[model samples]
Target: MARATTAHQLHDLGLAAWFGGTLANAVALNKAAAHSGDAASTGAVANEGWDRWTPVNAAAIGAHLIGSVGLLKHDLGRMSVQKGVGSMALAKTAVTIGALGVTAYSRVLGRKVSQHHAVPAADGTTPTASTPPDVAAAQKKLKQLQWAVPALTGAIVAIASYASEQYRPEEVHRGMLQRVLP
Candidate 1:
């Protein structure tokens, strides 16, 4: 068994936070916000939670990106000679880019909604009829984006799992053999 490096630890830990935090907020915080009394309070509650999470989320993303670069650098030699490794890395890169885009966009929408601190809402993403047009629109977008961030991040996790499997001794041996033989 190989020892885990700093990059490996950071990559897994950061991704775990990125995926788990968003899922928990979507599953629990958003819905729970609705129970905070009036429409305005609901929006405030949700915004407060999300706002607090933003800094931590940014840190997690930064750590993940740094770790990803480190891992890719370390794997370059193997990627060049191992069948399927380069393509798999490319796929993971694409998915990671997609996840980053969704996360950024969601944060933008969240800022839009949060700017109007006292804005009315039914829940984190649900806009009450009295919600101002701009805030309501932002909320609507956020509703969809909330799910998207987690889905895309979850995809990254899945791909990472597959990539890990490719690192097994037998798999690596077979992959290297196929690369040289064909």
Candidate 2:
């Protein structure tokens, strides 16, 4: 296989690891919530969920963006187009749709989480990962930050789709054709 293929495969693997890792972290957070009763600690699961998810979405968006571009590059000309039609086309369409769907879903979830409210701690302090706040305002802020994942992911998906459209092989090749042939 070509180096590019190897790189793509590695990138995909990284994404899979991150997604799985994020979910695992979420699970761990739930367990922590179950085991602990400290007011500062009760919602740690949601907190960690917010933390882990941000990077997960960011990584996912990056991977999809790159993948779309890669596919577009592979889709130019007669032989390539022939390979892309049928099952390949279906697969491509699925990926595009899935990215958009996930991005939208993530955004919605992020918004919901952000809107959630919590009581302020008796002591004034910004909630840190180490000191999970017992208060509502802090909880709300944490929830908003949790969406870093989805927002980043959506941004990535949006950018990749744009790149795929812009760098489409035919478009890239058109410029080449004019330069070379004319």
Candidate 3:
């Protein structure tokens, strides 16, 4: 069994953090916030949690991107010669880009919603409702995006798993031969 490189470890750990964080936010944080009281309070609570998490999430994403580049550099030869590897890489890249976009859009929506709500300063007090039509629309969009972030991150995790399986020696050999032969 070969020891995993630093890049591989970072890539896996970063991805784990990204996936786990998104899922936790969706399942636990959002639900807890929704139970906080009215719509404004819910948005404020959820936004506050996400705001606290943004820095950590950004770091995880940075690490994952850097590690992915390093891993790709290390595997350039196999990427060029292997049959399925390039396709899987492309798929992973596409999903990653999509996830990034969704995350950004979700943040934008969150910020828009936050503008109308009175976020609690320190005390865990329920905020007053001030949901204008536009803010309500933004909140709706955010609700959908909340689930999307997790779904996309989970897809990335699945793609990473597939890529790992493709890295097996037997799989790599078969992939290269298939490219050359067919």
Q: What C-alpha lDDT do the candidate models reach, one value each?
A: 0.90, 0.46, 0.75
Q: How far off is residue 163 in model 1, in Å?
A: 1.0
| Predicted structure 2, TM vs. truth | 0.46
Q: Candidate 2 lDDT, tens digit per residue, 38-80?
A: 5344444354455456666667656645754555455444324
Q: Best-fitting candidate, measured by TM-score?
A: 1
lDDT of 1 at 75: 79
Per-candidate TM equals: 0.96, 0.46, 0.85
Clashing pairs in 2: 54-149, 118-136, 119-135, 119-136, 120-136
Provide the lDDT at 141 for model 2.
Answer: 49
After best superposition, candidate 1 residue 113: deviation in angstroms? 0.6
The positional error of residue 147 in candidate 1, measured at the CA in angstroms, is: 0.9
- Residues 1-182 of candidate 1 have per-residue lDDT tens digits of 13237777788889999999999999999999999999999999999999999999999998888888887887788898888889989998999999999999899889999999878999999999999999999999988888988898898899889889888999999999999995
Candidate 1: residue 117 lDDT (0-100): 87
lDDT of 3 by residue, 32-59 (tens): 8767665657767877887788889888
Off by over 4 Å in 1: 1-4
TM-score of 1: 0.96
